[model samples]
Target: MGALLRGLVGLILSSVLVTSALAATAPVGGYTVVKAYPHDTAAFTEGLFYRDGFIFESTGLKGRSFIRKWNLETGVSEQERIVDSRYFGEGVVDWKNRLYALTWTDEIGIIYDIDSFERIGEFSYPGEGWALTRDDKRIMMSDGTSFIRFLDPETLKETGRIEVTDHGVPVRNLNELEWVKGELLANVWQTTRIARIDIKTGNVVGWIELAGLLKDAGVTGTQDDVLNGIAYDAVSDRLFVTGKLWPKLYEIKLAPAN
Candidate 1:
């Protein structure tokens, strides 16, 4: 069943403080909040994306895992489907009108019909699943490591992988993902940094340092409640970010670091 000992796993993985020297050489930047939207404080958001005027999210935790469709105007989830209790839900993404979701230790991936939220199929993978994002043809997955695995959308099987490196050092703890422009943006777990990576070369091209964002928005949280979610609206050119258990989501624009 791929049961994981939460405590032991936490102790090993929660020390996500490793920072590569390569990150020090990359261009860093900050954010400018264009708008703030209400967010469910109870959501431990693991995956996020925008589509058809709605925000789709995947929330984690063993018993509380769920995939929900959110109203950006109201910040309330209009519909949700719970994950099986045995799984700790992780990242989610949409491809060809179908939604794909991953579970942390269960090695399981669930596929659902976007309109009906009906479970249609399942696939398995080795190791853990941290987050998912897609371009036009393929799905990219992160497994809490330096590498991003590429999967064939048709077969949902691994096609290739690229190890993210800053300068030359491997950068780990990549979590939530989003594809913006032509680069892959990855949220480095437990930190306020988002690495903009070159997909083909796996080079960390730049970094978005988002420190003090929650405080600027007056949202409070402990160590575990961290910056973890990111979504983008390609049509409107809007970028959104939020955190685990955060009470607000911010639509932001990137401001190059001075």
Candidate 2:
């Protein structure tokens, strides 16, 4: 009888330890806004990236979709390409001196010359294009689902994919992706939190909470105004974030949450 009781206790302790370990590995990180920059309030920002002191952004809206290169300091578009009025633009990324821009619901992506903003080529995919980013070898794409697809940058052909999860549960509505260091940082639609995902495993290793970032920046808007853009400057190690229809952009530093 005593042996049976000891075995039961041991099982319970092991279960508890496993649960605690999982919780410890999945941390919710906080952010401190280091600076605020002017962003075009009329722009419904869908994708953003930093390169060579310029911010390349994609805006979405049926007739207003555009790919723009903005001066980081002044928020002025140095070059812009307005897409066809019938197509809605989505996410964008820079690879091999070319800018790739996706179109929502159209299943088409356009590639442009980074310097001249001229259309060089375009590719067709299967589903909606919600977000885009790239690593050293492959381009990462999302379609408002839990899955992230890997594509060959040269061919724009899907090479592989993985379903993203948080603590073994699927994470949907993944949007606005940026490759930071080695991890893929994705904005969760309709929420202020960004998921830090493992590109190889598709597991969310951590969450960056931007809960009060907009409010602290004195941004006022309706519920439709959700956080949606992420840009990282690898050279400076600076992180920038903004939202749909947001008036300001913020440069933030992440810290471990208590």
Candidate 3:
């Protein structure tokens, strides 16, 4: 009887913890979602970057990999280039006057000139590529795991890596990335929450539950179509969000959850 009682108590405690984690919510200090729509529905949007009012996007899938740019205002592809069918394009970032891109499961990252999307060279990685983002100094990458790797932009070498953790647990499946202010904004795949992560310690400072944001937009459905894309426009201080195969991208200003 004692053993059974202990097991039941443990289950009850676990349920409480799960509910608490989901209940801990905070107001977004200063975030406004940018309402923007892409001209085309990208099949697999692996990586996204912005420069000079144009978006540099990388799409996945072995035979359908590509790097392209779209006009921000018109949402029209101004230029596009294709990669070989053997590799899947992943995250993309800007380093100096060049653009760096990664490939899924290929362990190779491609580099190109920023002005012209031309493959200048390639570099090797230790794991599969998932997403890429950068700040003023280091290049940050995710590999579909709990860890985020930092690389040297000039050398493309693993300088160091930080494992993302929620409380004391590893947070896996971190996908699609954007560097906002000094923090790394990560889209936790398959969930309606985006974690604001501190890059130095892998600690999740806070999480923004996007359920209200989506429901407000009338995209009601299951959690399968939850949050995915994250992009920040520093110029206007606007945050843009969307999901996989989503018909429209919304620009929203997050009102703090009081």
Candidate 4:
């Protein structure tokens, strides 16, 4: 009887250690809306970023996909450029005075003059383009899969990639991306949570739960109106988010999970 009890205790200790290890791998987070600004309800926002006091956005849907520069306070477009009808826009980012826009399933991306919104050129890639973001040197892209690809800023060619994993499991369906403070923040498609990824290791270190953000703004749209779009203003240290067809853009501040 004494030996049996000792074995049971050892088993229980092993279970506890396993549970604690899993908990340590997955960190959770939340957010509070600091402010809300009106957004165009017609926009199917796929990519968003802040620069030079303007919110640069790319809206999707074939024949409706376009890029625009928006006024941050009023959500009004100061400049716009319509994409070709044959392409479906996916994501966009700005680098070195140029704006790059990606197309879903088209295997192509567009480059434009940031100030003039004029199409400068186009580049080709291999897979579907789900989202785009950039750090100082490399452009990062997602393809609705578990992988994030790093591309050359000047040549717009694939340089490297990493498969995103959460606690030894692959995390797929990675959507809109934004590089924030050395971490890659991604909106997983069809979910209310955002994954905060370690760029070097490709591990999901934390998740930012954004539940009820759109609903609180009275956005009761369909599944197509799911959460998307993340824009970070490095200068002001402000983070902004919006959804497809959402009427309000929220400025959020992160709160650590309990």
The C-alpha RMSD in Å for every predicted model, in order, reads 9.1, 5.0, 3.5, 4.9
Selected candidate, larger TM-score, 3 vs 4: 4
Candidate 3, residue 183: lDDT: 89
* Higher-lDDT candidate of 1 and 2: 1
- What overall lDDT, based on C-alpha atoms, would model 2 receive against the true structure? 0.90
C-alpha TM-scores of all predictions: 0.90, 0.88, 0.83, 0.90
Local error of candidate 4 at residue 110 (angstroms) = 0.7
Please list the C-alpha lDDT of all candidates, in the order they appear.
Answer: 0.91, 0.90, 0.78, 0.92
Per-residue CA lDDT of model 1 for 123-235, tens digit only, reads: 99999999999999899999999999999998899999999998778889999999999999999997888999999999989899887686865655446678989999999
Poorest 10 consecutive residues by lDDT, candidate 1? 14-23
Error of 3 at 89 (Å): 1.3
Q: Candidate 2: misplaced stretches above 4 Å?
A: 1-25, 219-222
Report the C-alpha lDDT of model 4 over 1-258, residue by residue, as the tens digit.
Answer: 999999999999999877865666567899989999888888899999999999999999999888989999998899999999998888999999899999999899999999999999999999899999999999999999999999999999999999998886788999999999999999999888899999899999999988879678676545788899999999999999999988989999999965
Give the residue spans of candidate 4 off by over 4 A.
1-25, 220-222
Residue runs of model 1 more than 4 Å from their true location after superposition: 1-24, 219-222
Ranking by lDDT: 4, 1, 2, 3
Per-residue error for 174 in candidate 2, Å, reads 0.3
Best by lDDT: 4
